[model samples]
Target chain A: MKLKDILFVAITAVLFGIVYLGAVYMGAALTGILTPMGLGIYGYEPFYGIWFLAAVFTTYVLQKPGVGIIAEMLAALLEVLMGNFFGPIIFISGFIQGLGSEIGFAVFRYKKYSLQSTMLAATGCTVLSFIWTGIRSQYWTLSPMVVLGIFVIRLASALIICGFGCKLLADGLAKAGVLKGYALGLGQMTLEEE
Target chain B: MEKLNPFLKGVSILVCGLILSFSYSVLLNGGIIAVSLILLLFFSKARLTSLVKILVPAFVAAVSIFFTGMMFTSGSAIAPEAVSKVESLNFEVMSYSMTSVYNAIQLSSRILAFAGLGVLFAMTTDGEEFVKSLMHQCRLKPKYAYGVLAAFHLLPCIREEFAKAQMAFRVRGIPVTPFSMKPVFAMLVNTVHWSEHVAMAMESKGFDGEGARTYYTVTVIRWYDWCFLAVTVSLLVSGTFLLPF
Candidate 1:
């Protein structure tokens, strides 16, 4: 990858790392508030998509095969540097999630950057990472119905925040001319010329 | 602990997590927590306040998880063979029994173990050194490593830009809250623009990832790093096998 590409990915990863940290804090507070209601386990579900943002966004913008994985991994590494409570486990999560995102794009042979692709990418992330979550969080010990409930919520979150949000963010940045020189920006330019 | 190679330290900690993933031994998990806490307190230069800050929340979260696990875990959650081995306690609440209690300990102890390892790594390793070690020992490309470092330095700038964007939103009669996405998008756009400039500037200064370069500070795997890795792995492996449930 080019230096500019690396920089783009790095900057985006770092930026989203901050957002991920905020989500963690928010999730913690929500977990605390909902503990009495016995819904504390689901407190972080809504924000799960945000965790996949760096991967989806970078891959969508860069339109590269491996950018999503690198972006996600870098973001996780940055989170560790920032002293996130989950530590190296986040690193493992990032890898799994990023691989999921890449698989989403890979389904289209890395040819498509459409909404469908992003949605699929998000689903891939959610499903793949859920496997790790299942093992790590002992979801197998929970009733099947509850596990299903958690999966549905997480999948919906990924589809909304990561799938749709990435598309919207990339379009907005392309319009703002910040994405000039990237694949997404070039696509915009080509459309204008056409 | 701080003197250990960052890369080695990370790998050992990751190995510990992986080992924990395979088994549900409370003794093993508790051992990890105790060792991590002791290292954090005595060997590492972590502040007591920071240690408390992590520990208190971790304890609270673990308790919550324990209760949740106890209440939700079904009697037949495990395999039929394993379920038969679990002796149901007389003091049962709903479906909760001794089996659920065991499951709960497994769940919460895993959390505590992960938290301890994570906090230990975060506290002991310097970010710069970690990156340096990645490049030097792990053979991560300098371009990628340095790219991360540069972006790390840009964090404060990005925060300032985020604040500015929030202020601008407020001026435009848009109610800005911590959860608002408008300012975040704006900050991201601005940073993307800055990144292009940064890349161009670096290129102008002959920055190339492909070129061979010399480093001012080098990280080599020392004898003690190997020892640390050996001890950590052996302890985790032996603990997993030898420790009673």
Candidate 2:
């Protein structure tokens, strides 16, 4: 990666680290509120998308092979530095999720930035995270149907948030002319054309 | 503990944490938590006060995750026979289930162990050393490693700049909520600009991003690292998987 790109990833990771912290705090609270009602993992559906946006947006902006993993892992490292209770697990989680989200761009061999590619990343995250969290969170204890329901909800969250949400944010930046020099920025392959 | 390579410490923590997370034996989890806490308290650099600082919040997180885990209602998660023996108690606005409560205790205790592993790693490992090890042991390119290293050193400066930017916004009468997009836009624009400038400046200073570079510091894994690795891996393997479930 270019030095500029590397530094940009670092800055983006730090900024998103703050966002992750807030989202996690809120997600935990929602879990607390919803658990009594037997809503289970479904309560956390909204927050799942926010977790992978850093990876998605960074990959979208840089269009590099490993920027997604690096950005996501760095964000998790920042979370550790910021004193998140989950500590090293956050980094582990970031590694898995980022790799999963990178599938969208990777499937096209980093060439395609289409909406379809982005949605694939979300669906990828949903499937990967389902297996990953199932073991850790003991989701197997829940009925198969409920586990399946939670997985579906997570997929929608990833689709809407990482896929569409990141698309909008990047485009908003692109249209404002801030992402001028970047590869997939507004000057090249504008979202309108896509 | 102090003698172990930073990278080695990271790997050890990660290995044990994975082992702990992979299984659902509440007894093993609790045992690991108890032993790790004692080892960290005595042998690691962490003080009791700091351990408590991380643990208290972890406790809260564990409680939340535990209850959430219980609501899964899987047939095998908790015995179907225990469902009827369940009772409910409402604390005015909140309700609880006896079976759910039992599962919550198991899950929460595991979370506590999970959190404790993190604390052990963070408390013992120095961030800079870990970064340096990444460069030497992991063979991370100078461009990325130094880029991140510089970013780590410049964190305080970044905070200052962000604060200054917020103050400027306040003075300019711009409405800024924490979740607002405008601020995020501004931050990204500035970060990109700064990254470009710094990259150019470093290149001009003869800091090439490519080719082989000699390291000023070395992070050789010592005997203690080997011992630590053996002890942790064996303990995790035997304790988590070998025990009868």
Candidate 3:
């Protein structure tokens, strides 16, 4: 690992952290206002799944194997450092979520950036998140119907925000000429071509 | 300034977080006294900045709780005749609905308490030093740890970009208000794009996520670290005992 790469990852991680924190605060506030009105679940759903955007951004920009993991971990670390309510829980989630998205890239052998891959990444992450929620018993006492509802909402949110959302962001960056060397690289070589 | 070793600080924060969580679940039922004691150390160590950081979340929580409680309990009367004589209403359903809302409010406050403790820790600690300690004491991989450090520094840059994005929107006659989806979406898109650039630059520098790495800064654990760890363990133990469950 060259010093420059280390520095780059570090810088990206910090940016990811700040974004994660801001999103969490906004998500929490949204949840507070919406819960009484029957819209609370969507608030947490979108923010949690949005971590995949960080993963995709890191993977797309870094164009490396572990960037996803490192970015996710950095965001988790920052969230913890900033005093998130869940503390270590954020770390664990980051680790798992990072791995989930990273695995999607790994499956393609880090050679593809198709919309299908993005969708797979989203699905992978949502599955991992669901497992974590089950282990933490976040859904333990809820009836089967409620548990199913949470799962469906979480999956839909991830697909929309992380899957399609990441694609949109990447395409915009490509258009702006910021991603010339990476997989989302400009001109005809971009993921949009696939 | 006397600095608490980074490892010790990290450990202490984690422990405090756990204790706070436990206290909220078990001891919170005992009322303000229990909550105050649970948070006493945090309060003593808090600075003005930390207090201000928590104020918004606290205020929101308080209002939510009050409204939820009012909605639920307004119909309940101590006297049996008071309910029917007052007016026939959907008292049972209202009460049931309020119970869930009240529980949510209580949960929100507990969340605020957790967030407050976190803000206190973040305000008191230094990011660079903390990463150094993680590397030295915890033996965290240098590449990963430094990556985190870099991310911390870039936060300001991202914030600046976020502001610029908002300003540009405002210039275009778009309203950039809180809870507005347009500005938030625009910012989100821009952030993802910037991060991609950051990643590519890192890749160009040969950051393949493997191989040995080195660092210039050193972090060491001292006697104070051990003391902090001991205090954390003791607090956890006592908290467990005091737990209502």
Candidate 4:
């Protein structure tokens, strides 16, 4: 990658972190509205875990190995600094979710950009996040029905937002020419021409 | 000109959050004393507007929970065989309903406590000062810290963009409901694109990723911060022993 590409990636990661924090706060506000409707049981809904989408989109466009984790950690750090309600728990969840997405990238050897790969990465993250939620919260003590409902909502969120959302973002960035370097290897062209 | 120091402002937020959270937990555990403590804290803050905001949601949640508990619970005793035979079909349904209601009440209380604390924190704290403290006192990297601050400041910009996008959609005869994920997704993509350009422009300016950075402002940890931390720790510790419910 060119110096510009590296720089852009870093900058994007930081911006993504900020956006992620804002999304979480917005999500919390929405949670207040939805809770009374019995729809709030799916924790992290409304905001739909948009940070995960941000991570997936960043990594997919940058096609970098640690992008997912770095973006997520930055976002979590930002959220904590912003005084999120869950405090330490937000940091812990960020680490787990980042690792989950990073694993998917590693499995593909950081060479793939297909929708299927992105979806797999998202699903992997969903499962990891779900497991963590169950262990961290009182989810284990709940009845089977409640547990099942939580799992379905989380999984659907991951697929719908992180999976599909990343694809849509990548496509848009490509159209805008901003993603030409990492995603399309256009950086190589600029170097060759120079 | 009643301006509180940013660090002190942050400490107060943390203090209020801990108090609210502890009292909430105590109340959940059914400790009347804990509930009283929470009410006391609420009164001392003298934030009438904030109290109203918190009360509306908390009251709604509490009522919903109570009703849910009542709906799903089975009464104290099982019906006798004769009564069971007469009400056999209805008994199981009633029991299930009551159980769901009870579960809802418990869940609602927990959620309310967390939500209340969140609202309280957001209302009292200075966002920029919080970021500055994180960088200076908390040892966060300047690059990342500033980026977060920038994003926070950029929120209004994003909202403006979202509004513009919605207007554009309406002009195109597209629906603009918040529930419609399609418009939201489109708006997000546009926002990200805008952010990328802004990031690139920032990079083009001699913004190199290098050396020790100096802060334009400093955050000193004061006696209030220490006292706040001590009170928070004590409250949390005492809460463990007191079991409100």
Candidate 5:
């Protein structure tokens, strides 16, 4: 990776760290309000994608190998530093989730930034997340209906938040000319033709 | 709290946390939490009020995890017929569900383990120290390491930058608010500019792209780190054998 790549990843991580901190509070409040209304804990499913979006957004902008995981991991590190409740375990989750996002772009040879590829990456993230929650949190105990509900909600959230939402955000930033030297800003045919 | 090497503390928490995450034994989780609590009492100088602030969410998390985990038991392998078999569990209150109680243990314990470890690490570990240790011990490239640390150190400055941007937005007579997109757009532009400048300045100041670098503050793992690790591992092993759960 180039120096700019490293700097972008770090800068993105720092900025998103604040967002993630606020997200934790907003997520808790949403769960509190919704859980008692028959929504149960799955009410918080929509917010899940925010945790995994940094990787996808960074990768979308940088369009470089390993930037996805590095950006995601650093965001988690900032969370750890800011005294997140998950502590160092955030690092482990970051590595897994980021890789899940990276697999999306990597499958397209890191050459495609289409909506479908972003959605595919997020779909993989939901699957990976489900697997992790299944083994560790004992998701097998939930009613299959609830399990399906969690799956569908998380998947949709990932597509909307990580896929389209992030794409739009990065595009906005690129349009502002902040991302000029980067892959996304140089017009699609500039550096992206590779 | 700050006395411990950040890297050692981080590694210990991750290892102990993994063990906590995987084990099904509630007693073991409780034991680990108790041990961690005592360590905090002895070592951490955190104020009691701040400690409560950290712990309230954890307690809430444990309760929610337990209750939520219970609801999931409906489709588990425990059979729908077994839901009515609260007779074996005995002692029933009004509208009590055995499935929820039974399934709640693993998740509740998991939450306790995570919360305990999280609190201890947060109170004890320093972010800069951890990054410094990574450079010193892991031989991380100075460029990336410093780049990350520099970004971290800029957290306070970022607020000032945001304030400046807000003022600029007002001067431009453009509509802006905290909830508006203007701040985010301005920040994205600002940080990108700063990062490019910093990278260029570092390059001009004789910074190599990627190579070995020297560290002024070497994080030495003290004897206490080993002792802490040994005790945690031992408690983990002993709990596995001793707890019937």
Candidate 6:
């Protein structure tokens, strides 16, 4: 990867790290509020997609082979350094989720930055990370219905936020002319010219 | 513990977490929580108040998980009828068996153990040292490490920009929520703008990401770091097998 690619990934990680930390607090608060309703598990579920944002967002903007993994891992590292409550396990989680996002783009051979590709990346992130959640959170202990509920919510959140949300954000940035040198920017330029 | 190599410390904590995942023994999980706490307090010099701050959310999360586990556990000991009754909220008092309760405790305690390990690493290790250690000990490329470090330092700038954007929005009478994307988009524009300048400036300053470079601070992998790693792994492995509950 070029120096700029590395820098962009790191920057994205740091930027989203702040947002992820906020989401963590939000998840905790929501979990607390929902505990009495027997729905605490679902509290974090809604925001799970936010965790995959760095990976999906980076991959979409960079259109690279491994930027998704690197960005997500870097974001997790930043979270740890920022004193995230979940700690080091998040690093492994980042790797799993990043791989999921990458698989989405890899399916199209990194040629297409279409909505379908980002959604697939988001789906990949949700499914792969769900297994990790199952192991770490012992989701198997929960009733299948509850586990299914969590999965569906998380998948939807990933699809909406990480999938379409990232594409939208990138398009907005590109429109504003800030994405001038990046692959996404060049792609947009070509489309405009054609 | 604070003096240990950051990479080894992270690996040890991660390994211990992985080991804890393979079983549902409460004793092993409790041991991890205790050891991590003790290391944090006495060895790592983490203050009591700060530890409490770190733990309050964890305690809340654990409690929530515990309750959720108790109410919805799919333990085989519980009859399918009881599991089905949970959805209706009309279960008899006998629906919750001892097995479900045990599963709940196991799940909650494991959460605590993972949190403890995370806290131990986050509190003890300095971010810069960890990144430097990654470069010195882990042989991470300077390009990535330095880029990460540079971005890490610019976090305050990002925060400031966020606040500025939020204020700018408010001044224009635009309604904004914390979750609003407008300010976030504004922040991204500036981030993308700054990235180019930052990369160019680094290049101008003789920053060669792929080239060999000397380090001002070197993190050594000492015998005790290995000792810490070995002792941690052994204790966790032995605990997993020997612990009854």
Cα lDDT, all candidates: 0.87, 0.74, 0.61, 0.58, 0.76, 0.86
lDDT of 6 by residue, B84-195 (tens): 7466444544456566788889888988998998899888888888888888888889988888888888989999999999999999999989989899999889998888
**lDDT by residue (tens digit), candidate 2, B78-121:** 45444445554343113234545656767778778888777777
TM-score (0 to 1) of chain B for each candidate: 0.91, 0.84, 0.58, 0.64, 0.82, 0.90
Give the per-residue lDDT of model 3 (tens digit) for B114-146: 454445445455666777787788877766665
**Model 1 chain A: worst 10 consecutive residues (lDDT sum):** A34-43
Worst 10 residues of 3 chain B by lDDT: B70-79
Which candidate leads in DockQ?
6
DockQ of each: 0.69, 0.47, 0.23, 0.21, 0.59, 0.74
Q: Give candidate 1's error at residue B185 in angstroms.
A: 2.0
Evaluated against the true chain A, what TM-score does chain A of model 3 have? 0.80
User: Which parts of model 1 have CA positions greater than 4 angstroms off?
Assistant: B78-96
Worst 10 residues of 3 chain A by lDDT: A135-144
Worst 10 residues of 5 chain B by lDDT: B88-97
Q: After superposition, how far is residue B243 of candidate 2 from its true place, in Å?
A: 2.9
Query: What TM-score fits each model?
Result: 0.95, 0.86, 0.68, 0.69, 0.89, 0.95
Pairs that collide in candidate 5 are A141-B72, A142-B72
**Interface RMSD after interface superposition, each candidate:** 1.5, 2.6, 6.8, 6.4, 2.1, 1.3
Give lDDT tens digits, candidate 5, residues A76-194: 77777677867888788888888898889889999888787788788877788778876767777666787788889999888888888788888888877777778888865465558
Regions of model 6 farther than 4 Å from truth = B75-96
Cα lDDT tens digits, model 3, A77-154, are: 776665554444466668888888888778898878777777777888888878875544323323355457667888
- Best of the candidates, TM-score: 1
lDDT of 5 by residue, B1-245 (tens): 66877776777788877776667777777776887788778878866678778887677666666667765566444554544657654544322355567667777777778888888888777778888876765666777778887778778877688788888888999888766767776877888778777778777887776866655777887888777768767777677777887
Candidate 4: segments with Cα more than 4 A from true spot: A1-51, A73-89, A135-137, A181-194, B1-46, B54-106, B168-193, B200-209, B242-245
Error (Å) of candidate 6 at residue A169 is: 0.6
Error of 5 at B83 (Å): 8.0
